[model samples]
Target: MEILTDYILQFGDLNKQQTDLIASKAKKLDLHKDDYFSEAGKIPKQVGFILEGVFRFCYYNNKGEEITNYFVEEGNFVVDYQKFHTQVIASEYIQAVTDCKILAFSRKDWEDILNTIVGWDKIEAKIYQKCMTQAIERRSPLVSEDATTRYLSFMEEFPKLINRIPLSYVASYLGITQQSLSRVRKNIR
Candidate 1:
């Protein structure tokens, strides 16, 4: 709860009562590796604040190959943001890449906070903007960089996370084949 509240506090100030309200509504969730926190085509029931571990945002491509687009680690929130706001089905999956512990709030509880707490929407907007910025910073380079460059950048940027994750997921996230990733790894070594 402290970790979650600390994260939220970074975006905006919350009085004690408001902070308590959020803490009371939070539910602890534990997800094993490979578990889907939210699935494609399902409406997410809760928005999760990661306390520990990593999650990968992925979807199937036209040829039915799984493609990873983003990785969310601890001290961040995870949800299909657009879908959650509109109460629509998600088009992508948020999957646990490691054994994870999260603090979460149901959609109804989140709405109650938004309705009852002043300035919460502003705080939310700031957090959303931060998430968007981080996403762009992580993803933009992938578009123009060669696969080797992408892999190298991924390593330098996420040294701790890369070792904890499977190379298959790393390859997918880098938009390269496993064989290519292996070749890169070997050549770099």
Candidate 2:
């Protein structure tokens, strides 16, 4: 709960009453490795904050291959925002890659909090902006950068990700085959 308070304090000050109100609406969840917080085609009811461990956003392509889109580590928020906001079924899945603990708030509860809390709207807007910027940066490299360059950049940005995630998923995100990723690693080593 203190983690939630810390996160809120980053955006604005919350008195004890306000903090308690928000905390009361949040639910704690524990997930095993490979457990899905939200699956494709399901309407996601809650947005989650990672208390521990890692989660990945993924989807299958036409060929039925899973493609990793984003990795949310501890101290981050995990939500399929488009579906959560629109009340539509999500196209992707949010899954735990390691045993995880999370604090989750229902969409309705979040909306209520936003309406009642001063300066919350601005905080939410900044969050959305960061999400969008990350998406743009990811797509830009795939569209314009060569494989080696992309691989190098990925290592520079998230060197630990290669060791943390499965090679297949990392390769998929890099738009390369696992063998290629292996070669890239070898080259770098």
Candidate 3:
């Protein structure tokens, strides 16, 4: 809770009252490995900040293969932006790749903060911009790089996660087969 409060403080000033309100409404969530934080076809009624562990944002293709779109690590917010803002069911799933501890804010609480806090709009906008920039960075190497290059970039981008998560998930994120990822790792070594 302190970590989350500190993170929010980075974006804007929060008075004692505001901080207490946020802390009061925020709840802790514990998810075991493979548990889903959110799933396709469901509306996510809360926004979560990862205190510990990793989550993957994934979706099934037409052929039903799960493609990992993004990874949310500790200190990051995990929410389906479109679904959260529009009140629609999500098309993607946020799955815990490891046991997770999260600080979650209910939809109503989130709205309350926005309504009551000063400079929240600016804070929100800054957060959105950061998320957008991260998405763009994650997309660029996939389109422009070869398999080995992509794998290398993944290593650079998620050094901690590379060894923590199953290689299959990492392979999927890199758009390569597990066998290929293994070979790439061997070649690099």
Sequence-dependent TM-score of model 3: 0.96
Which portions of model 2 show Cα errors greater than 4 Å?
Answer: none
lDDT per residue as tens, model 2, 32-52: 989999999999988898899
Per-residue CA lDDT of model 3 for 1-23, tens digit only, reads 78888888888888889889888
- By TM-score, is 1 or 3 better? 1
Comparing 2 with 3 on TM-score, the higher-scoring candidate is 3
lDDT of 3: 0.89
* lDDT (10s digit) by residue, model 1, range 1-189: 888889999999999899999998899999999999999999988899999999999999999999998999999999888899888999999999999999988999999999999999999999999999989999999899998899989987787797889899999999889999999999999
TM-score order of candidates, top first = 1, 3, 2
Better of 1 and 2 by lDDT: 1
Best candidate according to TM-score:
1
Q: Would you list the clashing residue pairs of candidate 3?
A: none
Poorest stretch of ten by lDDT in candidate 2: 135-144
Candidate with best lDDT: 1
Candidate 3: list runs displaced more than 4 Å.
none
Better model by TM-score: candidate 1 vs candidate 2: 1
